[model samples]
Target: MIETKQTMMNLPGPKAKAIVERDQRVLAPCAGRVYPLVIDHAQGCEVWDVDGNRFLDLAAGIAVLAAGHSHPRLVAAMQAQVTRFTHFAGTDFYSESMVQVAEALVASMPATHEWQIFLTNSGTEAVELCLKLARHATGRQNIIGFFGAFHGRSYGSLSVTASKPLQREGYFPLLPGTTHSFYPTCHRCPINLSYPDCQIACIDLIERVLFQTTTPARDVAAIIVEPIQGEGGYIVPPPGAMQRLRDICDRHGILLILDEVQSGIGRTGKMWAFEHEQIVPDIVASAKGLGGGMPIGAVLARAELTRPWRPGAHGSTYSGNGMACAAALATLDLVQESLMANAAQMGPRLMDGLHALQHRYPQIGFVRGRGLMIGVELIEPETGAPARALANAVMQAAFQRGLLILTCGVSSIRFCPPLIITAAEIDEALHLFEQSLQACL
Candidate 1:
């Protein structure tokens, strides 16, 4: 857990150029990509590439590092857990850290009734697990997802993910009975009509599909959604939409599942992004920030909802890995220490800059989100067509200028900085963003 200090120049010669060797000579191209200067180590909110170029990590490893890289508390927790046991004696035997984390997780959420949690290894796993829970609990088959959503890459989760066609291009015959409904993005309406004029047609579309189409609402096991769609341009569906879905789920005996995988744990300046509406979903899935960059995922459900899944109904080898639990526990404490407050203060500053950018450049279609989770829709100003080229170019330029960013949705530049980011950091990052936007333009 010690901070690493390997750099480019000092890299061993031909004998062993370990720092740059990962991508230069070895590894699969499809494993994803990074900048030319390979990173050797990082601390707090900074990452030093092999070339010794330090960059502010606005993307935070795609919103994974909640407490910042190699946090002291998290490192200590990992060290302590490693000493006790690097790997658990057996997956069945419960770890002390796991129990404590489970308790803390369930209690942290807002709900008048009892709840329970099941830990896993990744966000996709939690999401897939929730889907299974829906079917198992309701004894039904159908599952409804929304448009412009990015669930995960797994077979089940990806089946419902509708962000990019390439994600499903080669993989044919995805999970069946999974339907996609349009969500009222409000800013870039799919129906081409303005807000009040159209009255949130996206949500209405879901209702229409249920009533007029063959997909019977009663047969639907669950209605799954991200309180604020993360990968699909960090889109936050208009207010009252979520509450309406909750009511729909109740009326049809369908489970309401909220995937907070990326928007949970204060990323939205709230315990959970759905908290903005003060509504409690039947089940919630979370990961990413939950473990403070350590690998961990979980699904929380009302205590009664977990009843159908009896003993041995479901589980995983690393359901509650000791080290992951320790890291998650330490993360919870660290987030409370100061990261949450930072997110609350800095979220608005970043948003203000982004909104201003939209005003300056009509190409910046719409800006929307909660807390640090923000997204800027890139569009052809006149026609409102998605401008993926601009978004991608912006990300590339941002990386070149010692800042990192990501793109999503049809054509949206997204931002999800570590919760520990400071006001000064926000100002500097925004300055870089302005430069990146210029490059994109």
Candidate 2:
């Protein structure tokens, strides 16, 4: 059965329930809620829960599995690496795997001679490392971040992430000198100005904050952006929004940091999502799909950006283990081939299907984003305030129907299927999505 509730309850999913119960009782409450299906094993888009019920996973582990789960390439590469050494003292002894991965990254980066690389384990660590690079490069302290953007959950990245209050709750006295400005959300803009015609009020606000306002350019270390704000409803900035930010950063001598942790490595139909814009960031944070399904993060920058960072600037044990590097190298090859092409082709199909659905349902206020990184925004038909409740209902319904989807922003549902998804799979996911939205309505 491809996702029936009866099948959902039949397999090891029930036995896994015991593990969840024990985890909740003994483990930390901060673990948060999870959908009932327990993933037993997966291949392609189909994952069988403990109950032996198969479901289509559209979420793809929060955009980490762009090449799909347990692909033969990744398996073969990782299996080969398993016989080799895994970790080494990264700072003390450099591994050939990380060195080779860095070489590949530099080759993929924009035609620039200054692409230096640093390896980390996760997206959060990548951003954390990004901050250090900017600080060490510019000798500045303050940081300017866009509202509703999610960088990561660590202290440095979390402080910049202007999402829910709980994400920042109890983590008070966050990285100081960080300021939030209006995000370039074309739909339901905070500034209430029309896009393209308004000349991007969000970008204008950044100018106001830095040059005209109290945020002196001298103290600012870097300007961080998501290119396509992943968690912030997949909001795409206006045509010139990115270049404007680039100009502002250049005028002020501030480093431009792109958090491609979720958007990079072919997730957005490009090797780097920022390539859509002609501008180049001083430092880029990348993770998620960089290591295939395994965890790996990296800070890609110009050679000059890391000049000030000394030998011990940053160090981590698993920065680029043999397995992670092998998997990442294999992933890079896999994505640079067919998966990216599929994402470019399939993302628009899904978006068009969603837009058609939005025409039928007023609850879907707006839809925006690029490539496979798409979001359907929820809005109250009358008041126009964020329809968080509606978003939750749609997400829950989609999960129940065996299509794994995720929610984001104050009122939005994000769709980041694996780049390897086929046209038929995208259509099928949209079919389930339409049913979920109807039920939600």
Candidate 3:
């Protein structure tokens, strides 16, 4: 195993502290920083702070660096594209890079359906476009979303995002005709029932409750969801949950939109998490790792659904820019060639390690996830209640111990390392994570 040695005993070392202080004075206060990690540079799964402190990066810029930081292939692609051209307003003009990227995205979709693509600059934009298309295509106003899902922060996306109150606190009176229902969180069943035995009642609630009382199924445009809830605790819905939703959408003629922003691009072993369920969605919103760090997003939909969108229906200046498309093509190439398989292989090793640690730590209430996108829920040892404070403390402790991690949901720490992470890196991260847990206790 590659040993991680920390050169600095104290965190926020001199240079990092100065830069952070400068940032606070000029930068906006809306950004919620979990810890004071001022990255100077990074490669693979390793990072260096401004103060020369070395750390293992498990967060991967919130799981954006699929091929790891500054991969030669991505850098070269971007550099070459910059020399030829950067942006020519993709909405109005055509570019080979843009066409190629769109083709690549369509190719990644299930073979059962032919897909069309609309590019954007971020996941929020992709979701926003999906919302508009769903309503336009179906001529319906009402939409359905699940609780504990973090789609994005834009108006339409935020309206369906029920993950955190802070995200929707003051942005109320959001997009009209949107409602939320329970997500099948088996760990803490929202309906106070068990999985497999519960028969996935949460999904049925949409038809039985929401459709009957508030929004009629005929008036609903789409049902947006994450294959694996990202910010909402990496909660993986049990088997048949997805198929049930598919059935409901098909019966009601409502579109099924999968927000693969954080769960796509091979983060979950499969190219797209929805593929695991063997049901093709009407639309898929992809970003995060799509560009390997460059800003890019795409709304992929069945060709029939998008055929109604006329010219000037929607557009963005930077969407499908040559530079972003080039970077994305490189990222897709890297993922298909090797990084994707690496995620599948390393995920088991990391999961096994965390499960073993759970045996030693009573605070670990649950461990769940697919491939490299995993979560470890920390709870109160005596009462078995969610320990939010302990979760935050452990995250901070991990950072101080030269391991970069972040917490999501109420009491879970998420591990979304780069897809290029190796066996030694996984073992080292597990070691640092155990030490962080010990220190927190």
Candidate 4:
């Protein structure tokens, strides 16, 4: 049995310091970096920095590696494909691996809907594809998105992204016909109303106010949403929220687009997060974990909606490259085999542990998530105000204690470990997290 070494040498050791200095000088200033630890290698749910320091990784590269880092199966598949062929401009040409991946993804859908796929290179591209298709198919210009939701950084997606003002501060004159509405965040209700009595006022506001006064439903092309909001916090809406959106779309002829970049691909212990709500979206944007560690994204839509997008309507050079397809095929196989089931079994266990910590520490204002995608919100112990500083301190302290975690939303620590994380690893992470919280206090 392989036992993990839960300790690290002083962070930014000699080797890491050299690299960090060089990176700061050369890399773009737009990249948001959390910590200074430089990774040298990783396996399963653990990572080591350049100084031979080992730490338990719970971030999973921002929830990208569902199969974990350096999995033999994925590495072997990618290596084999590299030797055979690398890129062939999949948009214009064809490759067996690319076709096979599309077929597998179609089969992984929730139900039998005549679906077609358009491959891209990242989640943002997937969102861009869906945005363009919605406008093209519906022949409408307006789009609606949630206030605390993040789709991507591209022009069309960024226009709908309202998670942080910083992401859109400098960029001006975004896509013209985009508007934002409140999401059903039950923990901190956006409309200042309770769930059972509120009757989903957020969804109602779209039709009652926004449609009637500003953006008419007739001109709206689509409503893009995240099944579980990612960067805005791992916030899951109350039940029936999605159904209500689907009903609204049905009445308005608006395409319901689900941006599952962070919540899909077995991260929620299911093939797709929307399946939990039992709602079939008109289009689903996927990425992050789709290619294990490799970069890949795709847009899945019903045949009717996609039919309008004729050939050459949209194309990219690296759309479904051979290497990415190979890695994705191996990732899908592993996710289907046993990793997904393991995530299903382990999710509640992790949440329960987090709940216990919350009980012990009142500073932990809330705990919520589905499957491996979890969040613990931090607040001031006395006033219950959002403690953004406290959250950052806990994250840094956790790193010192050989734990790798991250912060999301305004003041929440998001725990998105690799889906292959073991039970023991989960327990260790919780223990380290609690210790960090105590240190911060």
Off by over 4 Å in 1: 1-26, 89-91
Q: Which of the predicted structures, 2 or 3, would earn the higher TM-score when compared with the native?
A: 3
Q: Would you list the clashing residue pairs of candidate 3?
A: none
Task: State TM-scores per candidate.
Answer: 0.92, 0.95, 0.99, 0.98
Model 4 misplacement above 4 A: 1-9
Q: Report the Cα lDDT for candidate 2.
A: 0.84
Give the range of the ten consecutive residues with the poorest summed lDDT in model 2: 1-10
Candidate 1 lDDT over 88-193, as tens digits, reads 7324886778888889888787768798999988999999999999899888999999887888889999998998888888997999999888876777677788
Best by lDDT: 3
Which of 1 and 4 is ahead in lDDT? 4
lDDT tens digits, residue span 243-321, model 3: 9999999999999999999999999898999988988999999999999999999999999998888899999999889
Tens-digit lDDT track of model 2 for 163-246: 778889888999988888887877776778887778886787777755568787778889999898888778888788889999
Q: Candidate 3's C-alpha lDDT?
A: 0.93
Local accuracy by lDDT, each model: 0.82, 0.84, 0.93, 0.91
State, as a TM-score between 0 and 1, how close model 1 is to the true structure: 0.92
Model 2, which residues run further than 4 Å from truth?
Answer: 1-13
RMSD of each: 4.2, 2.2, 1.1, 1.6
Clashes of 1: 1
